[model samples]
Target: MTTTGLLGAALLAGLNVLPVQAAAAPSLPRDGGPAAEVLARQEVLDRLADEITRVPEHERSLVAGYAGHTVDPRHGHLDLYWHGRLPDHVTKVLAAAPTGVTAAVHEASYTLRELRAGRDRLVGAVVRGEAGAVWTSAGPLVDGSALAVGYTPDGGGRHGVATAGEVSARAAAVAGVPVTAVTAAASTAASTRHSDASPWSAGAELTTPGNGWCTSGFGGWRGTTAVLLTASHCGTSGTYRTGAGAVVGTATDSDTGLDTTVIDVNGTPSGKYFDGGWDNGSGYAKRVVGAGRNNVGDLVCASGAMSGIHCSLRITATDVAAEVNGQWRTDLDTATRTDDSTVAVAKGDSGGPVVASVNGGADMQARGIISAGTGNPVVCGSVAAPTTCWDSLRFVPIAPIVSKFGLSLA
Candidate 1:
């Protein structure tokens, strides 16, 4: 387990496939905007994520998982999750590493590959109809180092109780797969209660003719065609609209394979994300510096319609998988708020921009899109110091989407 009590699960999933430079530490603000420590923390994580990706595939695979130090955010090293001894050479490389980032290996029960395969078998059983009327969704939990199979008991009855127990037994039968039960509940999607922008920008909502709302992931251009990035599940047919209800563009190139799409809009996107909603014009004008992967312990933030702007989410797992509308989406990424009090994500937050803030929150790097998150929140404790029950939120990383679509961030 990490110092933050995070679960160590799968590979970087599909996100760590690329190598990129970490953002340089932003200079301290002249007006005391953001703390120097805050800027340093972001830079360290950016460097860490970059260094992790720089490791060769063979060597990197030796790591089952990794997380940042919660107590010391600038510790400049990650706690590696692994089952047994790492090769001497791997240890040496990590120790003598020059990237300003390092890893400390921990003994884990299952390897990343084993855990990933474990969840695959469970999902396969569901698809094959071998585990009927049982699991609603089954996938690997990188942090917990096990497979989570979700089920919703039909009320409180002997038959319902028996079915849940039987499913657990069947899950254990899957060879080489550690099993765990997750309560599955259908969550109501959050909505865009308000928005404001004279012109459309990234993180705005895309409204469908039929009254559907999904967030615009980022603002940019595709060879002079004004375009906006969003979740592919948002549908290829929709009109881009500001929160104030002004039409801006049309949707196209919706690819569920990538879980991303583009919106061909009329005017140029401001190239800014609505960090504080467009109406207030509170945001950072982030440049599409380059594509990067999210690593455990990375301090990240997102802009959604319902949640607006919230941060303090730390990446917990990668190479995650989820079944959306009966179709399994693999190689996704997952994150959870470090402070349980902070909001991780909500429904309709989909397609919102996931960014890493730098330059004292003046700029950012696009990370991914909000895809899915835990459901059935149960409040615990007083409002002043309340705790929420939530697992993790999954995202479709930006690198793969840009690679597949041949688009550039605005």
Candidate 2:
């Protein structure tokens, strides 16, 4: 594939041109002092968290009493909250923490299961329109403190309720736990861009049938069929192509609630994905070893065809429910850039691969796909249709998508 359009030129200007080396670590912002320390701590925490959460559910008894967990990268501490005795498996995981990392367990008022039950109740109430328009999103806090409900203060005008206080009260009653209401910004899908090569790989730009564009996600298999993954909001039914006009695939299945879609590829898709800094058209491919869950404080990276690769982002929340394009998308995770000066995600980046470093950054583990974003609107050097970017991002976790679609990583 070749890059010859205006979008290609813009991408070349916006990103740092780097040599594609398969063994090179991903390009992340270089920082010193407190920021550097935080990044270092986050990396160690990420590995430990992965080990702790990777235990199979059937054999993991800790999950029942697991309330939540938080990583204070600034202090190099990982705190696990539980409602009762810490399970032996978790204890073992914590004991194995590498030097310089501190792990501790704390008692919590409720278990994750209980908190999720309450969150589900609140979500159901909102879905049934029983909460009015006051509530926009709801999820449990990472500290197992309370159910956080994102609400619009003036949303109750359409319903009988009036005021943020009333909204919080109603939500708390329904959730059966304490509730914290936060003002939230509306979410928009990050779709629009151009740039992709043949032998299609994740992070390549895909042109939708409507002439719009989105980033292709990881390649996977749906039973015996090879498929490509991308954001469902991109287009539920249509053919997708590369920037050079090579056919990529056609939509085979989609779940709008999760904002995920599977495309029947024209040819077998590769298990590798583009990595490193934006390559000015020449991109590096990194093998995807497997898939993993997203956890708070874990650092991850995103690769968008329009904006290129961005790293040093820390996951702040998980299982977030946000309204995107007028529909409620639950089980979403949100991450924010540690370096505020750079964009974490950009328009036309929708459906791009969001991956966590694995095997010491030698490979990547599929974590999620870019869904929507808000905050810090800035020019994205790409002349792509949507020439903007955001500092924060919301992504659809890969676990549910793989489970619901019966997909296995390619």
Candidate 3:
């Protein structure tokens, strides 16, 4: 019914979302870094959870039934894979945490303390005029989660004031099981044994970035070279920095709203991966010894500076909406929705790969860069920051991407 091939599928899987913050990650303590990061992450999420519940039913319904549970205190963050509009949840955030947020809504992250103060102000209004004890009395939605902030319990016995960590632990404990999680991160440490950050494409050592990451997704190859495929939003205008911390190239070309980009990296300092496998990520080379075909239901994966994560897919939808430079244009349409259910993405994961068949399967192929998904949870995992996930995230079909740019893989 749809004109989607192995190459097309990769491009069409729409992977597009602005980052929570453009600021860099702070230096974490080496010994307590892991634990501290996790706890701090929980504190942030706990505050978000409080804020989301304060909005009116119609608005709160945005995050209604989607998954927000599996985020344990260890990970310090909660994530979702959604199937609908990626920007909707952020709108809800603006409503609750108006102060900490900017009206511009550009890419940036927010803190929990800032969220709570704003959340408390609005929640206080939502619950006024009700007769009850201090804990059970009517309060506003501004600090609705405050009911659970410390030990303050509601009169109805539903929820109460608990500490940030306490609320997070409680919510995560009862989340049951989220359908999607970046399960790829769990697997990479086990099988992807080789030092993944070496040798760029063309077998040349790469000029690695301050924080280098790799993934599997190359537009169809030409003769010998395999061209890399990612998101344009990842490059142009300094939105995305390269692995080498250099603005290596612009998005050279991009089909607007498509979330695909073609960056030009040379063979001298390598900058690419071969396929999308979880066990051992593919190696980049200029030779054409491994070109092959792919099929449905393949297990593709990816790697990036944020960390490598991937999963298989059972192709669901095809022929997604596309536009170029704000014009209605169909540049590429090879997006696929795999049933693997891995919300395998975050801020910096963009312009990477949605690879297929790295688990000892068929010839490699690009499923799509990690665009947007319907089921992906909000990375912050807060009640106030209610998350969303659509049925299919996006990717630019590799076939058309390569054709549009006339790129010949080495």
Which candidate comes out best when scored by TM-score? 2
lDDT string for model 2 (1-410, tens) is: 12223223443333222221122333432221123444455556766776776642212224677767777665667767777666667666665566567666666777766777787787787677774546767777876778788765567344754566777788888889988887665677888224554456898888887888788998978888888899999898989888768888899899998898899987787897776544445556778888876677777888777677777788888777777867888888888888765778887888999987654465778888999876446555533454768888889888888888999988
List ranges where model 1 is wrong by over 4 Å.
Answer: 1-39, 53-76, 83-93, 97-102, 141-145, 155-168, 184-200, 277-288, 325-327, 375-392
Sort by TM-score, top down from the best: 2, 1, 3
**lDDT measured at residue 226 in model 3 versus the true structure, 0 to 100:** 35
Worst 10 residues of 2 by lDDT: 14-23
Give the candidate order by descending lDDT. 2, 1, 3
Cα deviation of 3, candidate 3, in Å: 22
Q: Write the per-residue lDDT of candidate 3 for residues 1-410, one digit (tens) a residue.
A: 12213222332232112213212232321111122333233334334443434431112324432211112223323222222233445445433432122111211122223223333332242235222211211111111122121113331243433343443343223222111111110001100112323223321111222333322234333344433455554333222233334333223445544555554433322333433222223442222222221122222344333433334332322232222222222212222234333344433344555543321222233444554432234342211112332323344444455445675543
Query: What CA RMSD would you report for each candidate?
Result: 7.7, 11.4, 21.0
Give the residue spans of candidate 3 off by over 4 A. Answer: 1-228, 237-247, 268-299, 302-304, 322-342, 376-392
Per-candidate TM-score against the hidden true structure: 0.73, 0.83, 0.36
* Whole-model Cα lDDT of every candidate shown, in order: 0.57, 0.72, 0.31
How much is the lDDT of residue 30 in candidate 3?
14
Record all residue pairs in model 2 with backbone atoms less than 3 Å apart, i.e. clashing.
192-348
